[model samples]
Target chain A: MNNYWSAIVNNLDPYVPGEQTKLSNVIKLNTNENPYGPSYKVLDAIKNSCNNQLRLYPDPESISLRDQIASLYNLNIDNIFVGNGSDEVLAQSFLAFFQKEKPIIFPDITYSFYKTYCQLFNIAYKTIPLDEYFNIKISDYLPKIHKNYIGGIIFPNPNAPTGINLELTDVEKIISSNKNIVVVIDEAYVDFGSTSAVSLINKYDNLLIVQTFSKSRSLAGLRIGFAIGNKNLINGLIRVKNSFNSYPVDKLASIGAIAAFQDIDYFNFTCNSIIKLRNNLINDMINLGFEVLPSKANFIFAKHNKYDAKIIYEKLKDNNILVRHFNKDRINQYLRISIGIEEHLSQLIYILNKIVNN
Target chain B: MNNYWSAIVNNLDPYVPGEQTKLSNVIKLNTNENPYGPSYKVLDAIKNSCNNQLRLYPDPESISLRDQIASLYNLNIDNIFVGNGSDEVLAQSFLAFFQKEKPIIFPDITYSFYKTYCQLFNIAYKTIPLDEYFNIKISDYLPKIHKNYIGGIIFPNPNAPTGINLELTDVEKIISSNKNIVVVIDEAYVDFGSTSAVSLINKYDNLLIVQTFSKSRSLAGLRIGFAIGNKNLINGLIRVKNSFNSYPVDKLASIGAIAAFQDIDYFNFTCNSIIKLRNNLINDMINLGFEVLPSKANFIFAKHNKYDAKIIYEKLKDNNILVRHFNKDRINQYLRISIGIEEHLSQLIYILNKIVNN
Candidate 1:
């Protein structure tokens, strides 16, 4: 728009993230955030790191944190890379492995940030449309294999906005058949229900699994995420990261993430509670004549055939409650609602029933 | 090199930062770290922020922290851009402003990261070598300017490794003459003893000043930095940032940085102490038959005409005292020693006397 801007800057249509409303009383279900707080041990670890030692730079390699992650996932330190968030880890992956002579392929309806990253990096991409049932057809990806091309795939285990998970066997088949390409399984919400592909990483050198602490770990504000992959692929990402920024994780973030891994009991308890709440919420919605999809994430995607989705989103907003509604074409009719605490979900269902009856 | 990595990754020779040793008794002087600890209020603020609220994501826009930075610099909020560190800020600037038809220009021996960033972004650059005395010759930059060439310019104000600062008038002359090209002044160590160019931000639209809390505010472990420039330029960076990662600064880092700005007395006192110790150390080195450069930053660059620089460095390291020595061609004779506390410097001087006398 301006003379001082770069050519790519003017062409970029940046992704608009879900609204983070600051109103204290609003029932915020817009972003898929965990309702429970982080474990007490996470707070203590952060406190322990915030002493007088903050004057010096943190470990540039993030060795201790990486070692902890490697142990938790049963992978070596050489097979893992950490960043400020999963988004950053994805951005580095795109630059490291996705840019090729031919276009990469991904589902048409997917995380919006992936397209935005392609635009920023000038990577050519082709959008393969999902089937009528909103499921990714694996056959569509097989045809795009070419000599000059590189494959970069990222679909949430329980995909975002739609909250439908692909079976772990299907994922394994895709990686095995397309041995020449790289397949990334984003497990941001996998802790809720879906199976993780992390266990299959050793079998497939082209498989890269991304996970975050924002959702199930309940440390979204701390900004930590990681990628588990083959040692060579992990080394490529480290090269890109070292060339870009040395210290991506701060003192508090590193300490809090390490402690989050240490407290396995708290993590299991909180994630289990969310899954239970999600199933109950789905039952309530279906009984009320809402078309809810099969969900395995911390959120559910649903629509009322009689009520317009935009109208429902606005009404909820007016009542000081927030839910996600997309303006994009194929998914605009649906609403993505996050699973909150018991009291918050009860309030949402009661209000929804009244609105539908009226 | 791996078969899956992009072609660009294979060509990159990434920058290697100075070592961060974990020895307890060593007087660490390799990287230019602040000798004193961060403010007590910064530690308190970080502790206060590590709570249940971490279950939610931080403000992606970082509005409050930007407001604090704007208020301190007497600039509008739109003119400020923040990143994980000055290194990231500089990298973004290279992608946003320096990828023009002509190559960018920088000192051949300035911040080593500048060359590394150029390679990472695939930007063409021509290094304007410093004069024989290791000073940035303004005349060299003026003569090389042409219409279809010269994207921008960047160098540390108090040039790194040399610890010398350019006059404000000389910098302004460069800005006025090269009105079409962007000029970035990296003032990472300016707060130690030199003046700042933040006051001239309103006068020149093409000028961008980058600074960090790592050197001045003593919060390096927290990873925070900012760029002050025209609003249009800042917005260009925001587009790139949004495409990459939304929340580069985490919740605790934002809160800790704000507290750092609030404690003006602590910041000023620490900087003053470092300045005094630096001057005393320089005098003592000269008295001991070493040639020390006139420094405006926290570190001193010195070498002895009688002894081998590498020998002296190895001797100091053997005694558990660390300092930075570059193996590069031009600066192989000098050692960059950070100014620590008075007692640390006294010990260093005693060891130096023994080495020289022996």
Candidate 2:
């Protein structure tokens, strides 16, 4: 550590994102990216926006894009807030609503970035353990479980690594239970099949639903994400945002995200296809002696009955296949694989069989 | 204000950026945007990078873009860091280095965002008043002025609103005086004509130089900016960035920025023409009885001695021309005008001439 480093920096254990290896011809399933390319409409809109208008700044409010999101959710413009990515929205949320006199609560096996954000913002936090089957138990979040105060709550709806989705009813239970604190539902993987918490945003004033174009919208490289919440929660997020970075969303990203929402037909078709592929992949893994979690997102978390998970991950990597293996507690034996197209899945299965047999 | 708002949000006076008015015919001069569009190569690069790769996440490391910047400055890759925009870099810098036991110091009439950042981060600050002619006196930063405490220092080169450049020697003096404190030179407008303190980074571990592609490369809409400094300082910034947002810059932005640097001849031509136009605009303002500052940036700060600044601003707005007029102490009577192209300038002069004659 450098002597000049701040106490915050020194204390931060920065989040390690999924590997973005640039290897060509690799069947990359590690990052949970959509197997398909962005819609033709998204590509066309971004291409059209690459003009001289780029000389000026974008609308800091991202009005048109917010309008598109609002209309999609049947919410008003005041309910939406946009940013560089959902990660940024989460970061700002930690700064805006999570830092208080009390500790916040999140799932121990949820998105790892939540803990990283707590460290960065100096927010005290307690991680409630997920169930043995890797599902988020809403009862664990009830205030009666702990006498200590809670400033806020946040977690991915269809949680990462485990890819297990909490039912919307259960989600509402947590929000209602946390009557005095904000409950952030990170629906980054919601579009895959899980029900959105967005519909409940109007009922729960403290509920904030964070989503991304990175996942279902197929715009990770464009870096756009947004929040849907009541006006006050959105305002708090926006206030932290304005103080951090005025123009978080760029011009091309704005147009591309707006177009992504506009082509509702394309979005639905893509999500349906991914869900179909996920089910097929799960069937194949189960037949191959793996126990896969009941996944509602675009990925599957599984462990083979015989083979070591890390060894299998390495063997697949040697054959030019990439899947994520977490070396963390309670889940080190599990492998999280993203659902690619049919051909990619066939190739993955073909390789996995060879590695297991060998 | 919302009752759910955090204490930080409640205390913050969010920065008001110059408007991105949707009106087409308005000759906008408020925000200091480049008069010309980015080099044609930027468009081609972004368009080419806009395809299927968008499905995957961008490089959180932003390696190639940092490489391009390092090569440009003839520094090692460790000396550089890239972010969404200089604004984000500045925000991270505030978190990384500036919050300390002592209150940081900046010019009273500098970029207004500095104070907003201070409030957002809860960092105490002391603003040294600019002299009668709106120039920062280097000696004012001497330890003798604030004997007991000083955290850090930052100000725009060719200082904002005044468009006055500080000599490199004076910049060195400030860094030298604050031996242990980080000195941030926000050289956002440096590409026009002012000397950048980037070269002095090797000598001072406490120095962090921030630059943006918005002004010179005409990429405000693209939102790309970078910082150069010692490896330790860069490491602190990186730790903060990774904790906050894994990837701030996107694929299109990375390629667009890299291509902008590759076409140096085009960049030089654009900057020279703007500098030439700024000289012409200064001459015109003086002849029209406006007291203009000696500008080293792509903008001028001037006031017509005969007319109230607010009235002139309102009159220009009536003519569908927009310029920034800050209603603050010492500089309320001035209009900070961005230098547009010859055609835009001609339109501006025609309108201003009419306003003055009337």
Candidate 3:
């Protein structure tokens, strides 16, 4: 810790993202990326955009892309706000709407980045524990808001690591009841299984739904994500954004993301494939003596009753397979594995059977 | 003025970038964009990068691009920090090093974004007014650093809107005298003319020089920039960056930036052309009865005593030519014109001659 650093900088415990290992043969599944490629149209659009026009800056407002997103969601242009990624959009939201006299609230076991953001922005936060069955209790969150003031709320629809989704009715109840506080729904994996909160955006002015091309749309490396909310909330974020970085989405990202939205058919097909593979993977794991969570995301959280998770994780690593194993208490027994292609799943099942039987 | 918004959000006056008009025929000379395209190799690299691999997230560390920049600058990898753009890099720098008991200092007549950033980060600042000739007085800056009170210093080299560069010797003197406070030399337009402080990074640990691909490398649309400094300064930026956004640069941007570095010959050729054109354009403006600054950048700052800059700006817009005229009080009389291609400049001169004669 250097004395020259800011007080906030010293206090930050930055989130460590998954390892981006360059190994050619490793069975990679840690980061829950779609195994399928982005649409051919996205690549074509990116190639077309690589011209002398790149000498100029991209549209600071990203108007055309926002229009396309608005059209897809049946919302007005004022409802949309885009950024470098959903991470950036979320970061801006925390700065714009989450910092207040009161503490923000979220699930105790949710996206780890929410806590990281709180540390960065110095936003006070309280994590309400989920139920004994690892389900989010809307009742628990509702009463806490009355007891202690809440600035905002955020939880992934089909939550990460656990991969279980809260029903849409439950989400609507929480959002409608908490009209005074901003409610952010991160739909990074919504396209895989659960319904999007975008339809509810018109009804709930305080509701802000954040989505990313990184997951179901398969454009993680392009760095594009956006939020749909009421015009007032979008304007608030745009103000913070314009103050921070005028042009967050680069030209290539803008063109590619717009094209990704245009190719709706391709998006649906790819997400359907992932959902089908997810079900098959779950069955295979259960047959191999592993207990799997009811997953709505692209990845599964599971643990074998007989074998130690850390040991199993190490054994898989030795065989050139990579999966995420959290060492934190209460969740150390489970490993989060992303759904890969059919061939990758077959290989994973083969390896797991060998290890479990031994 | 929503009640749910952050208190700081309501107080912000966001920076307004120069207009990027979508009109095609306008001789765009507002932002200091390179008059030529990036190297063919750069485009090719981006094309090659836009593949199925986009499914996975880019390297959060961006090690390959960092190593490429480090090799080009003859510095260790630890001395380099890359970001979405120099704007983002500067924003991070303000958060990382520009906070202390004392106020940060900058020229009164300089990049307006400096003040905007100060406001965004809530950084206390004291403006050191430029002299009558619009030159920063090093003496005024040096005397104020007693008691180790100044948090940091930042100014554009060949300062924007004036285009007069601080001598490298003078910069070294300041760096030597102010070893305790961080001194940032923003070299966004350094590649067009003048020497760089990057060579002195090893000798002065307190110096951090920021540069951008937007001006000289013609990658504004790609949104890439970097900072060169001592390891300690770079490490501080990395900590803030990781907490903020892990993957600021996308796949295509990284590949294109690396390729731009590789094609040194192409880079030199394009920059030389812009320099030659800039000299010619400045000479022509003086001949047409204009008071021009001694420019050491890709643009020139000039004013015609006979013509109100705003009126002239409006007339130029009518003639399908666009130039920047700041509404700020001090710089209101001036028109900041970016050096464009030879054909574009010839047409602009022709239009100016007609306007002046009439």
Candidate 4:
């Protein structure tokens, strides 16, 4: 630490993203990135955008892209707010809605970035423990039970590392209960199978649904994420964003995401493939004496009955395969595995069988 | 104006960027975008990066891109911090260094975003009035005079909207005088004709130099910007960035920027062409009875002696030509005109001649 650093810097324990390996042969699954490439149309649109127009700044409002997202969601353009990624959107959301006298609430084991954002913004927060089954318990969020005042609430639907999706009714119940505070539903993994909270947006003025192009649309490298919310909420995010970086979403990323949305067939084909692969992988793991969570995401969470999770992770790594093993409380034995293409999953199962049988 | 918005949002006066129009026939000169396209190599690099790897997340650390920048600046890779744009870099800089009990100081008429950032971050600030000629007055910043507690110092080199370069010795004086707080030298317009304070980074550990690809390399649409500073300051920025957004730089932008640095001849060609255009534009404006500032930037700031600035701005717009006019204190009479191609400038001059003669 230097004398030049602000006091906030001393308190910031920054979020560490999952390993991004440069090694080509590794069966990378840590970050839950899509295994399939984005649509050909996305590639074409990005290429076409790489010309003279790049000299100019991208539209600060991201009008066309937001318009496309609005049309897709059957909402107005003002209902959409885009950013460099969902992480940035979440950061802005924390600042826009959660900075109050009372603490915000989220699942303790949800996306780890929430805590980091709280520290960075000096926003007070309290984490509610997930149910023993690793599910977000909606009853815990009710004012009658929670007791203490909350400024806001946010959690990933189909929570990370434990791909269990919170049911739509429960999501609505939490929103309906927290009528005063904003309820942010992080839907990063919602498209795989789970229903979206986006449909509830019109009914709930305080509901904000955050989504990304990274997992389901397969454009993680492009860095595009957006929020669908009430126009006022979108305006609040826009205020924070404009105050920070006017054009967080770059031109090619915006163009590519628009193209990804245009191709429903391609999006469906890829999401379906990951789901099919995830189901087969789950059954194969169950047969090998592993208990996998009921996953609605592109990835699965499982712990082998006989073998230690870290040891299995190491063994997979030794065989040029990689999966995430969070060395945290209560879930240290669980492993998060992203669904790769068919052959990659087959190879993963073959290796896991050897490790578990031994 | 929503109840859900954080209290800071109510206090925030967001920065309004210069108008970006979609009119085909308009000679756009409002936002100071580079008149020329990026190097062919940069475009080629972005196109080559448009394939399957987009399914994966970009390098969260931006190691390769940082390495390229470090080599170019002759600094260690640890000294470099890349962001979405210079605006984002400035925002992170505010959070990393300038949040203090003491109010930061800057020129009253500078890049308006600095004040907007101060407001957004809840940092107190006092603006030192620029000298009568709109040049940054170094004496006012010295602790010996105009003394109040100061947390930091930041202003664009060849200060924005004025395009008046601060002498290297004067910049050194300010850095040396303010040794305790972080001194940010925004070199967004440094490549045009001014000397950068980058040479003084090793001498002054508190100095952080911010630069961007928008003005010089002409890739504003890609949104790449970076800072060069001591390792400790860079680490502080990294901590904040890691907390906010892991991968602000997309894969294609990183690759494209690397290619931008590779083609030095192209970079020099474009900068020199703009400089040459700027000189000619200045001469024409002066010949037309406008008092042009001694510009060392890609844009020129001038005002017609006989006409009102807003009227001239409106007349230019009537002719499908656009230039920036700030409706603020002290600088309301001036027009900040971005230098365009030879033909665009010639048309501008022809239209101005008509307006002045009429």
Expressed as tens digits, the lDDT of each residue in B1-358 for candidate 4 is 7889999998899999888788889999999999999999999988988999999999999999999999987889999999999999999999999999999999999999998899888999999999999988889988887474899999999899999999999999999998888899999999999999888878889999999999999999999999999999999999999999999999999999999999999999999999999999999999999999999999999999999999999999999999999999999999999999999999999999999988
- Candidate 1 residue-wise lDDT, A1-358, digit = tens: 7777768888998988888878899999999889999999999988987887898888888998999999998889998899999999999998888877677777888888989989988888888788888898876656454332545666667777788898998888778876776788888889998999988989999999899999999999989999999998999999999898888888779999999999999999999999999999999999888999899999999999799999999998988889999988888889999999999999899989888888
TM-score, structure 2 vs. true? 0.99
RMSD value for candidate 1? 1.5
Per-model TM-score, in order, reads: 0.98, 0.99, 0.98, 0.99
Give lDDT tens digits, candidate 2, residues B1-358.
6656667888898888998899999999999999899999999999988898898899999999999999988999999999999999999999898877789999999899999889988888999999988899877888877674888889999899899999999999888888778889999999899999988989999899999989999999999999999999999999999998999999999999999999999899999999999999999888888999999999999999798999999999998899999999899999999999899998889888988877
Instruction: State the C-alpha lDDT per candidate.
Output: 0.88, 0.90, 0.90, 0.93
**Between prediction 1 and prediction 4, which has the larger TM-score?**
4
True contacts kept of each: 0.76, 0.79, 0.77, 0.93
DockQ of 1: 0.81
DockQ of each: 0.81, 0.83, 0.82, 0.92
Pairs clashing in candidate 3? none
Among these predictions, the greatest TM-score belongs to 4
Please give the distance, in angstroms, between residue A66's alpha carbon in candidate 3 and its true position after superposition: 0.5
Predicted structure with the largest lDDT when compared to the true one = 4
Against the correct fold, how does model 3 do in TM-score? 0.98
